[model samples]
Target: MIIEPLGGSYDRKAFSCGVLALDQYLHELANQDVKRRVRNCFVAADRDVDLIAGYYTLAASSVPITSLPEDLTRRLPRYPVLPAILIGRLAVDTRYQGQRVGSILIVDALRRCAQAAPASFALIVDAKDDKAAAFYCKYGFRPFQDRRLSLFLSVATALKLFG
Candidate 1:
């Protein structure tokens, strides 16, 4: 499989992650969002076919320092907010669910965040459910105090893992 930016040629209708919202976003809004410069989306496609196997989106974001754990906050500058990259959406087509496509997409997202200009301090993900949160936790993401499904991984930690 090859990972590349979302393009007009991709067969979005053929992709389904078992979630209506996600599927709808890809089929309806993904290209428009990209055209508007709202978020950057990347898709994993089959080597020979114009089929999208999975995809993820990234955008600039911030987190309040006060919302972070004391241990994490104490080490950072006394700024009110910390810069971050939001993994806005991540989904694997049902046909590609067990093939590690999600894992590859996330790792690719983190690597891009780590290499982004202006430099991000962390990677944030708003997981859709408990199962989604658990998947992120396995990658060392920690839940924010305000929400169990909202999780983050420090860029320092991500660099160690993916740098």
Candidate 2:
């Protein structure tokens, strides 16, 4: 249950976890531009460093204020803005499926974002595909109309949703 920033010699093992546990479509997407976004990882281990439970990435990002619904924009202060991020990606490892590790990773992601990113308006992620979309949607994330693969959760909303 040890969760920390990704680094050290365990990267190869972690990336392999991503490649094998996540669908091919997601692995391919992660291999491209998305990798340049927020890339953070969480390692769950036993008494020894196993890097085995699961991991996910988080990065900063922005979406135009105009991309949000009119009501949301109006509710915000009158300045052009961008939503910020603590994106969740590469969320898998078959060895730990059904152990609720994914949920813990997400909770860690949100807590880190809320505590550290004051300029960030929301936590954003590009769900690898539809099934991922539903997973995010379950947590009060809303799909952006123009970007079908993307979803966002306002910091306030996310904190409340998870609490």
Models, CA RMSD each: 1.0, 4.1
CA lDDT, candidate 1, residue 92: 95
lDDT of 2 by residue, 71-161 (tens): 6777788667675975756465666767887777777778888888356788888887898888888777888768987988888877786
Which residue ranges in model 1 land beyond 4 Å of their true spot? none
C-alpha-based local distance difference test score of model 2: 0.67
How close is every model to the real structure, measured as TM-score? 0.96, 0.77
The whole-model C-alpha lDDT of candidate 1 against the native structure comes to 0.91
Error of 2 at 136 (Å): 1.0
Q: What are the clashing pairs of model 2?
A: 38-58, 38-59
Q: Over all chains combined, what TM-score does candidate 1 have?
A: 0.96
